[model samples]
Target chain A: MNRTLALVLYGIGLALISHFAIVFAAPYLATDVVIARIDKVRALTPNELRVAPPTSPPRDLVPMGNADTITASSWLDLRQGPLLFEAPLPRRGEYWSVSIFAHDSDTDFIMSDRDVQAGEPARVLIYGPGQVPPIQSDAIIARVSTERAFLLVRAIMRDRNDNADVEALSAELRQATLRPAP
Target chain B: MGKVFRWVATTVVALALGAGSAAALINFGGAFDARIVNGAWETGRHTGSASADPYSRARGAIYGLWGLPPSEVVYYTALQDDTGQPLQRSCSYQVSGGALPARWWSVTLYRDYFLIENPARRYSWSSTTIDVAPAGNWRIDVNAAGEGDNALPMGERDGVFALSLRLYQPLPQVLDNRATIELPAIHRGACQGSSS
Candidate 1:
């Protein structure tokens, strides 16, 4: 065996170790970029969840009979909790919302306009894959009961500026007033 | 000579170990998505400590990292006008909020993405006007039609029950969309005892 050949092999090994160490230490040398990015940006909240459960829970429940004058009331109780209305909900302006009784609870949230399919049960999700974090009234619920259930609703008014007009319109809808037909 | 051989063996093992750990980190990190949408990344979080039901917390953490602007979703909840009036199922909902899109925007409804077939002709918005709102923030009504009303027919018995809100093309400062939006609380319906 040649002594020069052995020494040359040892030199090659030393170079490789140095290279590997540098590569391994690169991340630490680069001032924690990932950590800094995380620190600088704030985490966004799921607006849907926040809206469903406001800072304080509503502390009352009342029943409307077969013929309750919804228009006469200051505000109606909502049926079902936030879980019923799915996420990525539309802001309250001019769309219709449905209220349903949560299966085993007394709470309720307004249904989003997206889930109101005629002739089917509303069964929307609260959160799901590739979806925005807001909840809406369009979820298809499995069933609905009219026994003074909870109801929280938002509407998308065709006329944003006509607040008083829209409020009157909403009251009219709630009243369900109909004229006699010949 | 024996010591040298032992040292070489130990170095090889250590290298192998370090390589394995780095590989694991990359694999786990990839599971989370980070592509930008409408100039910002939209993601989720399930941090509601009330129910630690399975993937809720994990999903919540992922949402926190996405860094997208938040919009108001507070209006979607069910409750009376800051009172205890029981709302009903046979009603419609109107939604509106936030600024218009600069580079595309949309509003979608989901029971956690299990979308329902709305009675209305429209389902979501990526481009333009809905039921109608003068503000850049739009609104649409979700319910059955009637007089003096431009309503989209609703699911008969299956009318809307629960829902969520999503804002796309969100402005940068709407960071506290979650904390700031004025949402209603879920009030319990009258007890069966009261109804009976």
Candidate 2:
């Protein structure tokens, strides 16, 4: 091939490869930024829940957040071992959910208020990839492919003006914990 | 030696151009394409799932991380009003709707991907927060100052904004038929100045 034609073809091939590589890597890269930001801002150790304060100029890591909801987050480090997830549920009419995301931003599992019994708290056991759970346990068991995952707890408020209710709920969500599995 | 130097330069330029173009496309082209269009709102079927295509996953990570799968919560975002005009912070809009087919739902306004700051500190209205009018209808005012009984603040910033409608535990009808689902209609009202 001529010199100019050969260079053009080489450039085209290299460009296509570069484009695909970036696109494939973007999700993992973006998710890493979020996990790092939350860790830095919250100064949280793995499995410790911190209910994000609903202040103006919201301080949460992600955008398009629901300010009306009291959200608590924890970085689940399954490298240590399987962890037990526990949280209080809201009333029947109110809304609440626990969403677990993989390192690549995939929704590994989500257990909402509707899943649990009306008055019972959520009890879930999360293990890492290829890890096994107890053969007999009341807690809902799930497995994630990544060693590090994210757990989000959402508690929706019925009335925005209810300050006392908000604070009380925030306190309860802050009590949501993840401990080493028994 | 001259030919070798020219080849190296071409390779570097080609890689740079490719990477830069990819970044621009993902950043500029928002997450949802034409997959599921409910009026102005749009959503993808595999959003927040591992099965999502590379483009969808990349865009979702930047636009909305920690989003639940559609089986748990279907998220719909609107960048424009029903009239095809981009939603701007300078304009007031009336978001009117009736009961949605979901156990719980919320409509929130986000400017530049974050909740707009305002004195009221109000940013959204959900199924429980909104007061039902006669015939189960409700209306929310999305304005700059973020005032009113049902107000979704867009803050004082001058720029375009987007609305996120989240339906958690959607009814079978909504999940089975997303394209024809009835979501709130965003009707643009008065504009503050020359800004459209």
Best by TM-score, which number?
2
Compared with the true structure, what per-residue lDDT tens digits does model 1 show for residues B1-196? Answer: 9757755755565555554543443323223332111111223322222132223222222222111222322112222212333323354454434454222334433221223334333333333344344654444444434112232233334423333334432355443343443321222323323551
DockQ, computed on Cα atoms, for candidate 1: 0.02
Instruction: Report lDDT (CA) for all predictions.
Output: 0.32, 0.82
Write candidate 2's Cα lDDT for B62-129 as tens digits.
88888888887899999999998999877889999999999889898888888776776677888888
Error of 2 at A83 (Å): 1.2
Error of 1 at B184 (Å): 11
Computed on C-alphas against the true complex, the DockQ of each candidate is 0.02, 0.68
lDDT of 2 by residue, A1-182 (tens): 69989999999899889998998788788888888877787787887777886634657568676666778888888999899988777542267889888888888988888799977889999989989888899999978889988888888777656888887777777767778888
CAPRI-style quality class for the chain A–B interface of candidate 2: medium
Candidate 2 chain B weakest lDDT stretch, 10 residues: B26-35
Clashing pairs in model 2? none
Q: How big is the positional error of residue A100 in model 2, measured in Å on the Cα after superposition?
A: 1.4
Fnat of each prediction, in sequence: 0.00, 0.78
